[model samples]
Target chain A: MSEHGVRIQLDRVTKQYPRQPEPAVDNVSLDIPAGELVVFVGPSGCGKTTTMKMINRLIEPTSGEITIGGENVLALEPNELRTRIGYVIQQIGLFPHMTVRDNIAVVPRLLGWDKARITRRVDELLELVGLDPSAFRDRLPKQLSGGQQQRVGVARALAADPPVMLMDEPFGATDPITRDKLQNEFLRLQKELRKTIIFVTHDFDEAVKLGDRIAVLAEQSHVAQYDTPGRILAAPANDYVEGFVGSAAAIKQLGLMHVGMLTGLAELSATSGLPTVRSRENARDALDIMLRAGTSHVVVLDEQGDPRGVIGFEDIAGLLREEVSRVGQDA
Target chain B: MSVKTLDTAYQVTPSRWSRRNLTVPIGLIAAVAVLWLWVSSLNLDSIEARVLNAEAVRRAVVDHILLAVSATLLVVAIAVPLGIMLTRRWAKPLVPVVMALANIGQAVPALGLLVLLALWFGIGFKIALIALVVTAVLPVLRNTVVGIQQVDQSLVEAARGMGMRASRILRLVELPLAVPVMLAGLRTTIVIAVGVATVATFVNAGGLGDIIVAGIKLQRTPVLITGGVLTAVIALGLDWLGGLAERLLRPKGV
Candidate 1:
């Protein structure tokens, strides 16, 4: 099977529970391009999960249509459709009685893969999730730490290598440190897999960190604003989205930019004493270094730690201003 | 950490030869030996000798075991599937009604139930088997439902989300997780079966109950002691086997 994702389109989808006046998700429409991570950010009861579930028909829509890769979702068997879409949830529900190998092999076994191939795939997946195959293959879920179990959850979802993934706050239950670590590892993995993913979360900061596009949702699953993180932080479409962006919009915008984006940096000199920041580090980190050392400029280093050039406070500030005005003009 | 340390840290499987497992069998052997010695010491008259002889004692012991074991197997066959059926979404409404009937089966005394069955169906091993099954079915049936219900709902949803059919989920996920509790219930049923099998002689189904009934009617203490001691020993021995089956049959890491 090809590892790349296919486009998903939702056309005026609505979910109305009987006896409820307002539809849980009312006439929402969206288009998600292949190989992008779109986050659904909203309050607890805003029907964001309901909207995502309709893609795989976990919660069937009351009206309208959803298509993945241009085939109507409602036309296919739900079990068949779900097999081709990876799903992960906050609870990290690993089957307790099965060994890690057996747990990861569930989907492949369902697909009727041969025993040798299943074993090979289980080991490969365990390695992909950063668990040592020989050490962990025979262990049960309760034997692992919470972070480790969550990693296995992700690996299990990816077992069939589905083109689309739906994650509902997959890291929500972990401790803060573990959550941060899992997010970083997941981001690195996603860079390579490039599956079209709908990540549902209430945390706007998480949306800013991981989402390629943010769909800020309001009551009854209304899409308040749908844009990139930089745009949403720079120019929120309305006060509802502005409230979500909060007061730290400028700093959050800086976080979206890297030092390598800075232009016309002064050439580094051997005698110049300056703080050093990596080129891949975000602009916010460079600004923090300048603020701490009471210096306007810090030397930017490349991958080999060689001095590439110097960036000053004005350079970082200019990047943020340029982004804001650019989005402002678009609005 | 080294493999040695990891092994020690999660030493979940207790050793098969641990004290807890060894004690029951050893105590049972000692009890049997004492009972044998005590019986031999009694200078028996003809009636005591007739009741306590090897052929008669052996027949009674064999009959009792067959009665208890067959009844237990029958109870398992009837109860487990019914319990599983009751837990399904469409069958949920039947749960309370079935449980009430099972409760009534348990609430009636075993002797009374046996006599009633004997009156209706006439007396034999079959009547006694039905009586034992009716008396012991409640625990296993109740436990089967409870065991499946107690599995984490998220795990079921996870299985469903992964495209597992309902039957596949029941077989692979639900049933394996439910094994420990189901086996515990079976253990209780075994003990109940053994206790109730002694009452089988009341309906002309031969067992250790015959010897005890004869001793009481004939007013012979030696016969009573032999029958009573042998019945208790068999009960303990069967319970030990049940415990061992529970530990062995339970799915690993559950």
Candidate 2:
């Protein structure tokens, strides 16, 4: 199996329903590079979902060309094309009557994979999704918790190991705590799989956390700004995008930066009484520790929990200023 | 925590011979024994004896069971596929028309339908069987359609999204999910078929109805009582079997 993802190109894709005054998605074009997770962020009914669905032909484009791995999507049979692309939705629709193993085996079985291969693949997927194959395989969907069910839904989508994946609000239905956990697990999985993924969601924070690149969309599937999370948070493209970025843009940007990014840290001896944060922890976590402890500095610890250096409030502020200036230079 | 409790509630009790499962059959047997004892107590006249003989009663009971079983099987065969076809995207327009025709079949009185079929075709077991199917088909057909329709559309979409063709979705997702409702409809059809088969005797198709009719014409209380009690027992017995089948056939975790 090829672990590398292939590029997906949507060339002026448009979706027009019958008798509608305007198309749902109007001439939307995007170039999603192989092995990158791109988030389509917009308000509800803004056609972001419609655009993502068009990539898999769940909602066919009225007039446009979509090519995956340089192959024309429209020319291929829709079912065959879908089998080659992974898809996950908000509801986590695991068939209620099917066992978890059976649900995940659906695509493999459809491809006419042999019994031994499908059984092995199903177990492997359950393990990949952080489920215990021995415990969860025979259980039906109703027996699992909501988060577990959603994990199975993801595993089922990834069953045939499609190079490209489409996820629409995959974590939207869970509570904030579970959604956070699932997002982290998904991020870890994506890191290993490196699939070309187009994720659609309205949650800007989620887009920031998981997307390698974010495409902030407006009405009619118009791309307002498409850039890395750091760039978008530092300098929004227009007023609408700025409005989406909302307040505390600097703080949000800090969430994306690590403590290691702040150079020239004071000696650990000088900040012995300060709160502590791991070097891998983001700058935002460091900031949170400082704010809660009412201290101006925090000690950054390495993997062994030994304090290697100290970071202060001024250092974070200085880093943000430099980032903003860099973005301005790029503009 | 709540899900665990719900899961435990669905666990099957270890014993298959639970009291709840035995109640129907035991009560039905008791009713049969009481009827037997009462009928045996009567000192019957010759006409009553002729109709109440063991050989005649056995033949009639067998005919009654055969009529009900065969008619219900035919209804399932005819109605299930037709219902599946009607719910399909291309055949959606034909739904109301077919439902209307099914409604007409049920709307006609059972006796009237049997007599008309006998008038049009010659009177026999075949005419009686046709009447039983027409009278009992509506519930199963309606159930199958509604059952498939009520399945969550999102599940169907998910199946399609995973590359399942329409036929595969129907077999693996739609039909299995629809089983509970379809089985309920089948149970109703079975009861209706048993009740309608009694009227098969009106078209000269042999059944328990013969005893009842003979008792009525001969003016014999023992014969009438025997016919009435036996028919009621058969209806109850068949209904109990239908209930068991409903439980057994329903897809688990639904």
Candidate 3:
């Protein structure tokens, strides 16, 4: 499984619900890398959800192909394919009758895992999502708070350890504070598991916080732009992508293109004195200084306060310029 | 949440039964006493003898309660599946006709139904059982379908999103959520059957109706009152008990 890469690609996928005059998802294609957290974001009625649902055949494509782990999903039984892909939805639909532990064990039970292994997996997953099994196990869904239930929902989705996960607004139901906690917890989980993920949400902030690559879906399910978060913010493909990012394109670009990427470049190595800040300094500040310095990019200093890399003006200017013209049109 | 509802490991809340269990039966006995007093004050010559002798009419009451329960259990077992089947998206279109059949079953003169059964199958307990079962299906079937249909769509979506199989989601999430509605239907069906069962005794079935029928024959008020009191108690008791069971079995915390 490790050697076999999981890359999700949608080649001209189209979905038109019967009796509905317009297509929910237009012909669109996307390439998402293995072990990356990619997000598809758009307004409520957009086809972002339709695109995600096609991967495992929850909604069959009217035309085009979808492949997971290099295998065409249509070639496999839908139920069999779904079992290999994790799905999480907005309501955090925990089984009301099931205990927290049993709820988390849903997929593993479906897979027919032995009791001992399944129990261990449930406990491990409960702990990963920040719920103590000692306190939470055996408790029914109604006993849990909203945030806690969402954690269980995630634990359940990840139970089978599927190579890819589909999340549709998994945190949309929670309060801002809890949503942030869940988002961060998910980010940490993804870091450790590195499963290829396709997360759908309308929240731009959530998309920025969680996505490795961000695909902005417009009305009719068109892929306005699909690029790394930093690249998209720095360089939007069209006016739709620009408006979707909000008018603060420069600030948003700085939010993603950190000093780390600039420091990685070979040209940035010659400058030893780096822009020094606290360990907690914002990526925005590092970017702001790089822009003011008129270089392609700047270096990131360490705890000892040393120069890391020399950033060129292109690092800051290139993508921002591409997005700049479109930003006004959207505004 | 009851302490019993929770495991021994933790506490939830007091069960509603703790106090009511003590209060309800005691209250019923008081009502029985009030009825006895009211009747004794009447000085009705036949009342005492009719009740004390365990008149033949009182026999019908016991018979009816048993019929209602047995019929109810059978209907639940049968209708749940049928109801669930009817609720499937592809099968949903069939619901109207099935509902109409259930409605017709209920609309038939319950006595005529038994008479038909008696004429066809011979006069006895079996004929009455057939009539009662026919009447019971309307509530059970209607409730089952409604309960299944009422399951939260988002929960089903979430279950699917987690890659759960269709059958698994139906069994665990959909069924549990639909339980309250199903039980509501079950209760209504049982109550109706309990009332109907007494009338079944006219067809040679033994029940509270037997006491009522025998009381009228013997011109005995005691026999009639005793049978009526017990019949009422049984109806109310089963209704309360069914309600409690519904509350107890409902997916805890939901």
Candidate 4:
């Protein structure tokens, strides 16, 4: 295996459970680049989870190879390999008997981190996940709400600061409002961390919102199409890929752009009373703000919280028009 | 939400001297006091004639305590580990077999089991101890297996996925979650041991049962009451202690 900036590579991977006729995952290959979040989206029993679990060797592949950071994953001991990769699941299985601090400290402690470092890391993670260390550190999992527990689950997985993370519907259990809030927070966190992540979800919308590239999987874990969310939405490879893209592919394409990415900022002087959106917010959010304010333009704030530019209704409409025509040209 | 309301409800219940909290301890003390007065009111001459004097009662109680405690400790040492082992993959096939053996141990009457052991090992302290331990192992063993098995599989999976070794998972996850139910099993075993050890005196192991047997043979009512009261009090006291241990040892907010 040759090392590359690309973090994980799967070559012709296949998994066949005993007594089952067809393979759960068959002859699937993927390359996940470093510091990018790639989502594997598909319907029920599509082998999306089976493929993700193979990366951690939770479910070993019957054939083919996987390499992480240029080293063959199968060569490392399963437990040792797992320690180097973070994993979060939908159940948010925090150890019920452990305090939040202890739960977060699990991986670091297993890796033989000293007490002082583990303590610092645990508090850092609780804060990172938007949990107050003082209030939540000593509390058991049962004491926290479903959303809070999931946050702790994410923190616990991040404890050792592994370079790679595997998340399987980590936000699937919460109510829609909480789920949206968690997704937003998780996206913001991912921006700073930049770890290579393989996120598994059945929701194509979530893939568009979070994925740097989306791998639309079908039965047998076959990659129906693997491309950037914008490209997939603008030009799905075939009917199967288009079906998974959902009906509003043009609208989903707008979600891929931030307000900061839009060029030709109109004069901010004219938008003084208009609603404001953050530069880091999606173009869809900027459009929503403009619509709700009943204004032609909204002020876009940069990272420093200062107004950097203005995005008007025309910019959003222009972006959508470009997406529609691009798809038309590709067809 | 519901969790917030539950927290407030838990807080409203006072910690010290609450009726719910003090009921067991208070009841124990009152019962012991009444037992003492009744025993003291009995005719000393009749009790002495049946060999049920204070010194005899003291010796019998001591013997009974030793028998029950020793048997309980031995059972715990064997059964808990065996139960945990049974839950593991290697031992899974053996679980049904071992549980069936435990079922047979309990199915046999206590007196019959003791007599059977005596026939094999001869009527003595060793045979009596073996019988009591065998009879009492089932509850603790069954409870331990059930407790560990009932731990959420997701928690175990999460532990494994986090790179925790099997031993670490057992110590940090499985065992801790299993404590409450395991303690319930232990309490049952200890209480059973205390009651069953009285029959140990049949093989001349020397316990509260000696007085009861002597009283029955001699037709002495006072002696019988004294023996029964002493045995019952000890059982009650040990049971209360077990309850306290269970509460104190339980993980918070379980």
Interface RMSD of each: 1.0, 0.7, 1.7, 1.0
Model 2 C-alpha lDDT per residue in residues B190-219, reported as the tens digit of each score: 888887788888889999888888888888
Q: Identify the runs in model 2 with alpha carbons over 4 angstroms from their true place.
A: B1-17
- Chain A in model 2: its TM-score? 0.98
Tell me the chain A TM-score of model 4: 0.88
lDDT of 4 at B170: 94
Cand. 3 Cα-lDDT: 0.77
DockQ of 3: 0.47
- Deviating ranges (above 4 Å) for candidate 3: A1-5, A259-280, A285-331, B1-15, B29-52, B55-58, B107-123, B214-220
DockQ of each: 0.59, 0.68, 0.47, 0.59
Residues B103-192, model 1: lDDT tens digits: 788789999999889989999999999999999998788878877877888898888888888899999989888777777778778888
Question: How high is the lDDT of residue A296 in model 4?
Answer: 81
Off by over 4 Å in 1: A19-21, A267-271, B1-19
Each model's lDDT comes to: 0.88, 0.88, 0.77, 0.85
| Candidate 1 CAPRI level | medium
Candidate 2 lDDT, tens digit per residue, A1-331? 5366899998999999999999999998899999999999999999999998888888889999999999999999999999988999999888888899999999999999999998899889989999999999999999999999999999998999999999999999999999999999999999999999999999999999999999999999999999999999999999999999889889999999999778888876756578999999999999999999999899999889988898889999999999999988997
Q: Candidates sorted by TM-score, descending order?
A: 2, 1, 4, 3
Docking class of 3: acceptable
Report how far off residue A211 is in candidate 3 (Å).
Answer: 1.6
User: How good is the docking of model 2, as DockQ?
Assistant: 0.68
Writing each residue's lDDT as its tens digit, candidate 3 over B1-254 gives 11121112111122454665756667777877886677566765554455444444345555787798988988888888998898777885687788778889988989888878888788777777778889888877877777766677888876776667778788888888777777777877888788788778777778888776667777787767766787777777786777777778787756
Instruction: Specify the highest-DockQ model's number.
Output: 2
Q: What is the lDDT of residue A90 in candidate 1?
A: 85
lDDT by residue for model 3 over A1-331, one digit each (tens)?
1222289988999999899999999998999998888999999989898889999788899999998878999899887788788888888777777799888887777778999998888888888889998999889988889999998888888888788889989999899999988887888778888899999999887898799988999987898888777667766788888888987767766665455544344444456444443323445776667667655455656567664445455645654564556554554
Task: Please give me the total number of clashing residue pairs in predicted model 3.
Answer: 17
